[model samples]
Target: MQHVPFPRSVRQKASLAFILVMLLAVGNVSIVQFLLREGDGVAATLNVAGKMRMLSQRMGLSALALHQYPGLPDLAPDQLPTLFDEAHDALRLGGRAFGLDIPAVPKALSPQLLDVRQAWMRQQLAVDALARAPAGDRVAVEALLRANTDLLARTETMMDSLVVQAREVQRRALYGAYALFALDLLLLGLVGWVVSRRILQPVQALARQCRALAVGDYAARSDLPPGDELGELGRALNDSAGRIERLLRDIEQEHAALADAQSMFNGLSDNTVAGIYMVDESLRFIHVNTRMADMLGYPQAVLADGFPLHQVFTGADYETVQAQAMERLSGRATRTRYECVARRGDGEPIELEIFGSLMSLHGRPALIGIMFDITERKRAEASARRAALVYAHTSEGMVVTDADGVIQDVNPAFTAVTGYSADDVVGQTMNVLSSGRHDEDFYRVMWARLQDTGRWSGDIHNRRKSGEEYVERLSINTSYNADGSVNCRIGLFSDVTEKRRREASIWHQAHHDHLTQLPNRQMFEENLRLSIEQARLGGTSFAVIFLDLDLFKDVNDTLGHEAGDQLLRLVGRRLTECVRSSDLVARLGGDEFTLLVRDIEDPDDIFPVADKILDSLSQPFALGQQTVQISASMGAAFHPRDGGSDSELLRAADLAMYAAKEQGRNHFRVYAAEMRESVQVRQGEFARGPDPASAPAQSG
Candidate 1:
């Protein structure tokens, strides 16, 4: 049994009783003293009234003597004035004693005092006049006697009224003293009764109950009345007793429940997958389940020998665990979950995820935890992280689209190539990047191929964010669901616009002159062969004109190769202008050019083109500050009429050109079978080192 306790010390109750006793005694003494003081005041007032009466009678007697001894001057003056002054003093003293001019005087006494004072004043005045009159003046004496009579009668009445008031006051004081004594007796009796009932009896009952509680009788109660301090205390004691009793019952119930819980905990500890453990405030393992011991690779008996928490982890991990435990113990957190490497008894480290909470065990602060093995999960997460890194950082642009060809995601390289950020292209159709260069039929065919093969690889022309056109080498593959339906598409591509431009540049460099940008010898020969082949197939003859600049070497010797190059460029431009757009104009080596005219109706048509070449070269060329005039020696050969092969036609044109030069340069000549002899003689002269003065000059 248990019960509440009240702090009703015996010493405290005794002290309160003593204080009440002392208060009662002091009250009685005070009342007695007050009555005595009131009685003394009434007696003093009665004495003052008697003195006033005596003084007034004395004054009257003195006035009578003055009236009787009308001629006794000495006695009349001195005695009369002395008696009047004495009476006035006695009257004022009486007024003061009766509380006149003070708030204590009764309202009924005021007018009586005033009347006596007036009468006394009148008598004194009369007495003074008599004293001042002639010593034997009987009339003055009679008048003084009369005034003294009136004054005596009024003073007598006033004294009588005061004596009556004093007697009444004395009687009332006696009555009051009796009443106060009675009240003191009653109060003392009441105080004793109250102390006995309110304080003493209630306190005694509380003391008995306290004793009973100490002896384990929890059912004892004071049950005092309310509306007093003692009653409040009783109620408090009763409440405390009830709470204590309930607490004891709860302890008994909790003890039984704890026994049951311990049994259940042991059963679960042997079978549950998780390892459960408890550590005391000093970080020493106080309890470990069978599973916990097995998880740590320790025999249950050895672990039960109380291992320190530090032995279960590496040094750094133990330190971290200690810090976290301290935080929880200090109330920063109630529970926490964290990962740490735990060492087994065999000294092998194992990764674990621990869910821990702060709790009280056996009335001491402790930590309880449930640990799970997480090594495999951590390894898988690390592998996934590596794959994510590669996907994020690869250089090739990649885009993922849904089955409907709407973009779902893009990598950084995609933004770099297409200038469209993931924010711009996600959820947008793939057509957003299309250059609109491919017609519907082209896309229809492309989609057909894709659907059939599940892949497509080709060059695609696309538009960028800047509206600039670029080519990409794109390869796309389709992904399918388990049902073989298309799920999504992945595209990998690289911008090849620069690559295509570089390839074009290399081809141009192979076939064109670097200086004049005109077709060089290789291109000219190929075109000539094609023209000869066309003539044979169509049965129509075309013309090949061979032209050379006259005196061109003199210009190079006079100026420089740079100036010669400039002259050649101007010549090439003029020659291109002279030929029809359908014809081919090629620079066949230094200062020599060939024109291929196709679809010639007559052989005479070749002569006008040849004449135009000579005429254009005859114009002045501005080479730097020098305006130099130059001309060309032109020769024409009709294919089929001249030999059919490329070499045959080119030789015929060359021989005719030398014939024009031999005929004296800056003129055109058509090839004939007769010029063959002169061309042979000139070729023999050019091969033997012909003189510059005689040989034809090539144009600059």
Candidate 2:
């Protein structure tokens, strides 16, 4: 047979082209998004900063104009509007020459800049008042003008600072954009080279490995050959080659080993045992032994029928066996303990058990099957009753009970599980095993489910003869005789008391806060809803108090969050201690916590509890080796008085919570319905009012 190897370079060329195009597109997207877009953003900011600088220059020009045309004493009182108007009109034109938004820029700063402009207005008003006076008193007007000029200089300095900051931001952004563009180009070059290697390198290595295997090299395997189909072929070749090597070595040594091992099977087969003339797998001699030929009644000429195994076993069964063996061969993947069947001369079938693995054989997928006959052993097993003894029975527990729940057959394990033995309660009813906690209803339901479904599975709590209760995972099954009538009832039982206990513990841990082990927000809300229902049913005063750790975020950001969490846990412990054992203390997430103290005497009782909570958190917490002090701000709202509903009461408490935080931290405050107005009033009071149109009219 002749063989031709496939070329790796030709196979990888199309993939290489696709990879190159993707790399180019990626490089272009990186350029447009990171480089050109950033450059555009920097240019936009530069324009804004440039505009601010131009405004600053215009302000300087206005100051220069005031110096050039000073308010003169020589100018007549009636002609003063003309002088002021001329200066203002000329300054407006000069402002437009630059890109200054003169009206808007000064307004954004502190009112001191507007105050300087107002001082100039006051100066003009004084001048008008002096002109109307009996002898034109110009002294007050001169003092006002001098004061206005000093304020204008201060305003100019503030404007200069703003211009400097804007320009600096613009300058940095420009430099960063260019630097980023340069780095982008360098990364794009590196990526292109990487893409080239990624496309070509693997295919070349696969080619080298394939060529290494083609020349009778059995010790070879391939990683992949770029396609799933070809890669699978490569694996099959590797597996087949390995099997062939082992087969050849075994063939060379089989005669010597057979001489040593054949005595174990002497006289096992006779001429009439299988009713077939002697024939080997390849239609050769019956045995690589002399006595086996004597038993099978065959001469050497009769053994060699000169027929291929495939031609002898034809039809569906023939195709099935060959297909299974060839599939294992082609996968270079390994296998062992494989089974297939072959047809006998009398039309009877013989089953074969073969064990082999994949190996490379001159770059071809192949196999070496070692066949054995198991027909006699299989026949004896199927003809008799089947009993499977399972040795690893840790996960499976067995029990044998008679019709009346009497212990008939029991293993030593049953005594260890239920804490009962054969002599202790053998004749007793199943009720003696009950913990007596669940009523007769539980037993009735269990019986009903088993009767309806033929099986029932559930956890059962049972008492031992010594009166100790143990929980068990109980599965009850009803067995039937030949006619499908009931034969016996079997219950598989395993003690799961420890497992149930652990599950309960885990559920409690998840719902409760870790450090305080108090009911968390989720549990608190649930229990609170239940509490509210109880309160409504029985007329009682109850209150929900909300507590917050004051400036906790600042402490966490400045110090570490560990200190913050420790502080929160400490607060939780203190809150629990302060309330009654019957009351609830819950830690909400972060620095917030809540106390549900029911059966209160009055709303006033909440104040003392809130005060205690505040005091408790105010005290230092022992965190690690360090004693760190943090405090709480408490806000409280009462049920029925503050809110009839749970959500309403919580909201009221939360609103008051922000109030406590606002009024310097570390204090308890009761909910005031009008507190919202107070905050709004303060915001309005802090804001500037409209300038009133007043008594004096000034020059333009």
Candidate that scores best on lDDT: 1
**lDDT per model, in order?**
0.77, 0.59
**Candidate 2: tens digits of C-alpha lDDT, residues 1-700:** 1275323453464455556567666765775565454444334333433433333334333333333344523323343344333323323232221332222232244453344345546545554444444433346445434544554554455445445545654566576657656666665665565444544455465677668767766666666554444555556766787787678678868976796555533434322232222222232223323332232234434434443446435677567655555556667345555555656555567665545444444665444433455566677666532422331233445565665566565545567776677576566656667887788898889888866776889998988657788888989888777897666667778889899999989988878977667787788888778888888899887878887666566666655767666666666777778989989888765566888889987778777777777787788777777776777777778877888777777777776776887887797778888865654322221111223552111100
Model 2 error, position 118 (Å): 99
Candidate 2 positional error at 191, Å = 99
Q: Residues 125-235, candidate 1, lDDT per residue (tens digit)?
A: 887787678766878877777776786677677667766777787778778778867876886676677567667898899899889889877767888876567777888
Clashing pairs in 1: 549-698, 549-699, 550-697, 550-698, 550-699, 551-697, 551-698, 552-698, 552-699
